[model samples]
Target: MEFRDLNISESIMERLDEKGFTEATQIQEKAIPIVLDTELDVVGQAQTGTGKTLAFGIPIIQKIQEKIEENGRKNKKAVKAIILTPTRELALQVHDEIDSVNKGNKLRLCTVYGGQSIEKQINKLRNGVDIVIGTPGRVIDHLGRRTLKLNEIDFLVLDEADEMLNLGFIDDVEEIMSKCKEDCRKLLFSATLPKSIMELVELHMGEYETIRVKSKALTTELTEQIYYEVKEHDKFELLRRIIDKEPGFYGLVFCKTKADVDQLMRRLNDENYSSEALHGDMNQKQRELALSRFKSHKIDIMIATDVAARGIDINELTHVINYDIPQNPEAYVHRIGRTGRAGNKGTAITFVEPREFRRFKYIMKISKSDAKKEKIPDVTEIVELTKTNIIGKLKQLIQTENSEDSEDLENYEFENLEIVDELIELADSKVIIDKLISQLFKEELNRKSYGRIGDYGSRKGNDGRDSRRDGRNDRDRRDGRRNDRDRNDRNDRNDRDRRDNRRRNNDGGSRLFVALGSMDNMDTRRLLRKVLEKSDVSKDNISEVNVYRNFSFISADEKTAKQIVDSFRSERRNGKPLIEYAKR
Candidate 1:
């Protein structure tokens, strides 16, 4: 139903029209009328990104508008509504949405969150605001400072209640609620109704009505779910292959921790993939910058942890990759929900190691998603796909040119008709077209393959410098004795080259041992990517990457090596420091 049909103010309808929001989402349709028409509390249960903000936001704004119309505008300066969110990002998002609806400045709105100056928030509150949106901690701080008053607040909203509980803010939330007037109408929105949330509702709300928007078995029907059972060592290669195979691939790769997010982002950039990392370690400005780049398509991939990815609203995302399986099943749903939005087709792929297979299965069972198993596409398959895409584009061009509505083509004059006729006389145009296509395909394939296989390919035993040089020399040899002598010399040189290469690959530079390796789904490419992306060391300055099951060793120039070790000395993955210099 349209927002205009609801029993809301005309000003709201005008603002909604300006924002291009004609119809209401499911949650909005069900909850708005109840909030506007009655005094009862509400519990809205729905998945994230289903427009819960507007569901509660519209009613809160409308109530404030009504109070202003009923009472004099002079008396409406007090804070009448308060929205509590799980994080500062969410508070900011909700504040923005509400501000959009309050276009006429009829109701003053302000957001309070940690990290910004508390004094600034105090100044805004003292100036007077009709609605206050904030995190629990910051709101409590304001209450403690006596800078915020809730006795006059008539509307209360607890958004992402489950997330707030998970972050251990339930005590603060209850304390804030206790500060509010007993008659204030409370609206709680959560993805899941956990036991703690239920108890909070029982204690806080009075005769509240539950509004649940049932989703499809999968969080999104537009997303095609799939998984690949890959070994830890091969994941980076597979990731690269998948990226190479898909031409407009913009994806979000979800890792399990801040360390994984940092490591994976570095690796992707090292391999020339346009990517950025988002995790708790980044400050607010850095986080905003990374998110802005992703939204503007300045970067094609976003490597993020679950907590850091919250309140991120990007509608044109193409894919979501589970680089590491989430411990919580609902997290998987939340991660993939970022894509397949606004009726666009999207894809979600998960990489599951053998050890994590059971955990993955449990997640699938709980999420009620039947993600299909798929094999990683090999290089030949990717080449064929590219060829097919090119051919399809050519066929489309031909069809468009030959269509009856080709006014542009009719206006054009062919100055080379004689040459075209000669070409047609020599061979049917179909044969010539096929030959040209074959040549173009070969060239395209070669162009795409360059630099894809990194420098490690040259380090193979049979593919090294000595064997190639000796093979060329053998082809030029004539006499058997001379050829034999040359062969012996070449063999000796080959042996020395092999030994030297091995030494360089093993211990040519200062070494540092990292605590995460194959067991954590890490390999040489990932290790190098992590070190280089997070440190000042260039890829060429680094050599000798050896990965073990639980730990790994890397070597770089002495100065760069010390820098890397020092940089990561206090850096952590899963709450532990990342690297230490190896003992001799």
Candidate 2:
């Protein structure tokens, strides 16, 4: 049904029209009315990408608007609502969606997540924000710091509740709930109603109204599901071949971990494929940049972990490749759901290792997807496909050029008449075409060789040794030497640092306590990226990044450290500061 029929305010309706959201999805339709008209808490069960954000967002904004109208805008600074998500990406996405709906209505909203400046979030809170969207970790950080007060919160939303439980944020969520106004309306949304979710609801929500929107089967008729049984080591090669064989290929490749995402992206780029990595290890800006590049076609492939890939919406995506299959069948459904959208045909291909066959079958059964086992195309077949694609393009070009009228041709200038005449004299059209095709075949062969996709079989060298084995040995030796050199350099640097510390009594550098670490999916690169993005600190100015469970410390020169503190003292991670001078 139309959103206008739901009695949405003019301001919200206008924003929806601008966003091209005329009809609401099932969850939105069912949940919006209950949220806007009732005082009872809601438990909404729907799959991902079903517009859960706007379902609760619209009503939340409307309620805040009503409160403002009754009490005047002076109460705008007080946070009236908070939305908790399992990941920083989801939090940002929810904030963006709700903020867009609140356009012209003027609701002050802020997003809090780790790997960002906590002080900035605190400042935003201090100035007064109507809504705060954040992850559980960052929310807990703010709660402990007393920078975020929920005593006056009118609405509290737990989005992706099952995910939060999976990530072990249930305790934090319950704690956050305890600090909120006892009468605050709670809304819990999840793809599945796990036992943990039911327990959470029963404990926190009294007499909640349940809304269930049954999701369609995971595999859609518009999407062709296929799987290739390949050795783990050969997966990359197979991926390369598929990309080469498909014309104008754009895909989202899902990996299992941040390390897998990074390594796969590196390998793809090294093979001359345009790609970017998205994982929890990347800070917010990096994640946004990667998504931007993917959307703009600056990169053709987005290599992402399942968690980092959540809440990312892109149209015109042709395929979803499971570089590593997800353990959860529901996750598999979500990954493939990124494509085959809006009636456009899409393909989902999963690379199944031999050891994973049983699990893969379980996934197929649970997802109800009729995935056919597909054989990987050999290099020769890929080369032939490439040739056929090129010839098809050439034919189209010829047809377009020849389709012009004789009068149009008469108006064209013959800039190279003699060159054409000489070519015609040397060779007939068939000979010329044959020569061109030969050149294209040779070029495709050369490219395949360069990409190493053509070297699936073993080859022997002139010295009676396998060339592949020799290559591996050479690479191992190089890696060993590099490791040795790095070890030696690290030892020398440690020695120098010890001597310097003794001389300066540890006064030469300062340490800062950042409120992010392993729990927030932070790493050295992400920490460095966050520092560089939020402050003027360079890579060389920061050192000794030691991450812990809930916090981290970094050492820098006194001057640089002071600048960092000054820049980030008002910033936050998740919703707390990422840096502070080490407590002496």
**Which regions of candidate 2 are displaced past 4 Å?**
73-76, 226-240, 247-345, 349-381, 384-442, 447-584
Give the 10-residue window scoring lowest on summed lDDT in candidate 1. Answer: 474-483
Residue-wise lDDT of candidate 1 within 114-143, one digit each (tens)?
A: 556667888989988889998787788778
lDDT of each: 0.76, 0.77
In candidate 1, list every pair of residues with a backbone clash.
none
Per-prediction TM-score: 0.52, 0.56
What's the lDDT for residue 457 in model 2? 26
lDDT tens readout by residue for model 2, 1-584? 99999989999999999877899989999999998988999999987557788999999999889988888866556789999986665676677679888999998999987656668888999999999998777787788788899998999999888766755566778989999999999999987898989988999887689999886765678889998867665788789888988888999999877888898887676446899999888898988999999899999999998768875798688999999977446678889988898888999999876555554664675466778776677677777788788889887866665456423767655568788778889999799777777765543554324223223222233222343343334222211121133234445657977887554326678888998887888765466557765676654556456667888887887887888888888876777666777787
User: RMSD to native for every prediction?
Assistant: 19.8, 17.4
C-alpha positional error of residue 580 in candidate 2 after TM-score superposition, expressed in Å: 44
Please report how far candidate 2 places residue 137 from its true position, in Å: 0.9
Best by TM-score: 2
